[model samples]
Target: MTDSTSISLPADQRRREFIGGAKATFPLIVGAIPFGIIFGTLAEPSGLSAVGALAMSIIVFAGSSQFIVLGLLAAGAALPVIIATTFVVNLRHILYAANLVPKVRHLPQRWRILMAFGLTDETFAAVSSRYLQQEDIREAHWFYLGSFCAMYGNWVLCTAIGVALGEIFPDMTQWGLDFAMSVTFIGMVMPYLKNKPMWAAVIVAGAMAIATAALPHKLGLIIAALSGVAVGLSLQMLLTQTNTHSPAPDKEPQ
Candidate 1:
């Protein structure tokens, strides 16, 4: 099957959806600016050339993995080790793609490929609510593209600026601006904790993360993610059963 939002609408609706997506993603973009800049600032010191850094941001487009790679490189880790660590860190994208598959299951191959390339944590966070919460979206993929493109463009520009300023500043990454990423994530998640499954997932994930904080090679992250998924799934199953068994309301007289 192809991968798109499936439903088609008028050009006006598509434009509105696209604009809405861009506007919704703008705040997260603002938060990500510093994180992107810090990555760029640290890249050269981490043994990457300017072109290499820019290319990684453009090609890899994974902020977390890029930073992990840089850190591993700086620490003199073997190439295989660096690659494996980045792979492990990025496994969550699999879950992201699984969740999004239904929305884009009918699109053409090219659009699906573009959407996969553009899938980032920030864009996923912004786009999921729009797709899952709304019952009808005339052209949802356009909205997804809008958010993805805005974040992607912002990240590239920030990286470029950071790289250029890295030589002059030399300590930009050490400036404690990376905390904005945490704040941005918190903002994204807070609005969605509307039910037990969501809350369970977050709580279990947070607890697991804390408990496994000392694990080597960031194995703790994997544990936390898995535990959260299990908990969320279990809770969802229970909720589904409960709903299934509940008594039906009496029908009113016709």
Candidate 2:
């Protein structure tokens, strides 16, 4: 399960995988639509032209960083500062990529590149669950593709709708649509709290976020994320050590 090469799949299964991924990603997509819309709604008033907003949605495609970019633009932050801040906010994606590289390392260069472009928090959540369950993981990339495409397409479409409605509802961004994404993430993560390390990570991260909320430019998010990662890693190391040192369970006599 640790390493897999892309294997030829039967056509029907490929279709099934793709469709399955889309379905798995559907709820998150629904949750994200509002966030995407709010991004477009805020972008114009935040000093980005309509074309610029749409381009950022398409090119950047990271919702958190997009919002940060818009805020920094509106505040007249220098270009280097904006870039550095956004980069820091998005450093989590590097963790995501590292987690997935072993699963897809043997795929074609083009396939790897495409998946890299399509990777997102939502897609990673959905596809990582699928990859863990599927023994025939070679075809799981198609599922990833489906989830990524659905999210990407949904974001583009929602951005357009928000842009068109931006004039009609100048205060749409203030309506609190972005909170749905938080609910969606909670839903996604709730199912994965299978061990102590995960619970510790979640608890520590939440506390850190609240404690650091006043920090500027979304630094709280990065700090909380790193704190959570550290807690999880330390707990896992302790667990590993405990398991390695403990005596094996006694075998029952037949």
The numbered model that scores best in lDDT is 1
Q: After superposition, how far is residue 94 of candidate 1 from its true place, in Å?
A: 0.7
Measure candidate 1: CA RMSD: 5.0
Alpha-carbon error at 39 in model 2, in Å?
0.9
In the range 90-168, model 2's lDDT, one tens digit per residue, is 8888889999999999899999999998889899999989988877897898899889989999998888888989989
Q: Estimate each model's TM-score.
A: 0.90, 0.91
Candidate 1 residue lDDT tens string, 115-212? 99999988998899898878775488999999988999999999999999999999777789999999998998898898999899999999999999
lDDT of 2: 0.90
RMSD of each: 5.0, 4.7
Q: Could you give me the TM-score of model 2 versus the true structure? A: 0.91
The reply for model 1, stretches above 4 Å from the true place, is: 1-9, 246-254
- Could you tally the backbone clashes for each prediction? 6, 0
